[model samples]
Target: MRITLERSNLLKSLNHVHRVVERRNTIPILSNVLLRADGTALAMKATDLDLEITEETPANVEQAGATTVPAHLLYDIVRKLPDGAEVFLATTPDGGTMTIASGRSKFSLQCLPEADFPDLTAGTFSHTFKLTASDLKMLIDRTQFAISTEETRYYLNGIFFHTIEAQGDLKLRAVATDGHRLARADIKAPSGSEGMPGIIIPRKTVGELQKLVDNPEATVTIEVSDAKIRLSIGSIVMTSKLIDGTFPDYQRVIPTGNDKEMRVDCQTFAQAVDRVSTISSERGRAVKLALTDGQLLLTVNNPDSGSATDELAVSYESDAMEIGFNAKYLLDITAQLSGTDAVFLLADAGSPTLIRDTAGDDALYVLMPMRV
Candidate 1:
């Protein structure tokens, strides 16, 4: 196989695919990326058994063939090359080695036969829909932080994506939760998306897909089946296996009886939590919230360290209320609100609290109260 591609184009495509390749793998081919040249384009693909990514860039394909080369090594080489330099790649018949050259520099990278690479199914799926690049970005950014890092409950490790009815209209909702906190965001679904099956998109796939999308106004085609999902944007496509286990019925965790309400500027509230958390020790990052009339007092106390308190004018119309929560959780939830102010619905000190955006009913977050 022989092909010539621009250095900048090669670097961009390689950077997208290389992240999907694992650094250490039992199978050598898993550490390599598959490069294939078609009529006028070169495709770079990398997979980790569970997720597969393919990126295509414009190139001059003198000969149509395929080869596999070390992913990280190739990425680093092309990244260090001159920005506009043209890259030439050629492979020997034996497939024992591949030569890569840019300008005056030449390097021979060990190669594996393209047949040795793990096979991926470019399977056909039903339920195809288009999502605006910006909307998908907002869905991911608003809920990904609450994804669980614990391996025991693998089902809770990804964002649950599905279509649901809101006020007699179908809406796309992304929900993520660790035991302590949960985030849910919704956006109006385009026509023909109603009745699609719910799927849990794994965390690693979410991070990879984020890189391929740039223009907020661009449209992305999404296809989902029972076990896998595909997101295609221009010359890139990402396919990932969905988690098989059932996600917890997250609706029950959302508090509806929380009558004590407080409305505060989201940015100010987030900054106050940040400052107060500084005084708390590393082990327990706890912050206290005290509400009365229209004023909110934020405090953090640590027996071994020090304490902090800050006051902010807010909109509160209920009896006095006090609650404590993990400062990190509070900050994460507040940061997701798209507008200036956030509404906090609290039941009591030991109960769950509900949070929503003041401007719209598009998204909601729930936090489990902590003992101070």
Candidate 2:
């Protein structure tokens, strides 16, 4: 295989495909990236069995062939090359070693037969839809933070994606929870997505998809099946196996009767919670929120550390109530609010509190109170 490509273009594609290659692999071929050169472009593929990423970039092909090489090493070499340098890659007839040269620098890397690379088959997709990159990013940003990290409950380790009918209109919803806190966000369902099956997109796929949709103006095409999900944007294609588990009925956890309400500046509330939590103990890191007619008091007390209290004027008219919450949980939920004001609907000191952005009703958060 012999190919010539601009250093910048090769580096960009390498950065995308290399991340999918695991640093530690028991199989030799799994640690390398498969490079196929033909016609006018070079295709790069990397996978870890469960997830695979393929990218195609334009290159000058002197001799068309395919080979596999160390993904990280090639990425590092190309990254450190001088800007605008042309990268030349060629493999011997036996394909034992690959030669890489740019300007005054040259190196030889061992190559493996591309035939040994694992083949990833994307099963039949039941649904295919298109979404604006920005909208897709919003869905991920709003709920990914609440995804559980516990491997035992693998079902909760990914964002639950499905379509729901609301007010006679269909909408795409993303929900995630880690038992303590839950986040739900919705957007208008794209056409052709009707009757889409609910699927749990694994955390790793969520992260890779986020990077694939960096261009806000670009349109992302998503194809989903019972076992796999594929995301495509321009020349990049990301495919991953879905988590085979059932997600809990999240609506049951979302309270419906909570009426007591308090509205406060989102930034102000988050800052106060962050400051007072400094005095909280390392284990619990709990903070108490006392809300009265027009004032809200935030306090944290730790026996080994110290105590802190801050007061903020708020829009609360219900009877006085004090609730205990994990400081980090509050910060995570509040940080997602894009509006100026955050509205909290409370039932009692012991029940879960519901949070919403004052500007939009498309998203909501629920947090279970802690015993202070």
The digit string of per-residue lDDT tens for model 1 on 34-120 reads 999999999999999999989899999999999999999999999989878999999988878999998899999999999888867
* Candidate lDDT (C-alpha), each: 0.90, 0.95
RMSD to truth, every model = 1.1, 0.8
TM-score against truth, every candidate: 0.98, 0.99
Put down candidate 2 lDDT per residue, 1-372, tens digits, no spaces.
999999999999999999988899999999999999999999999999989999999999999999999999999999999999999999998999999999989999999999899978997999999999999999999999999999999999999999999978899999999999999999999997899999999999898887888899999999999989999999999999999999999999999999999999999999999999988877988999999999999999898877999999999999999999999999999999999999999999899999999879999999999999
Off by over 4 Å in 2: none
What clash count does candidate 1 reach? 0
Q: Going through the candidates in order, what is the number of backbone clashes in each?
A: 0, 0
Off by over 4 Å in 1: none
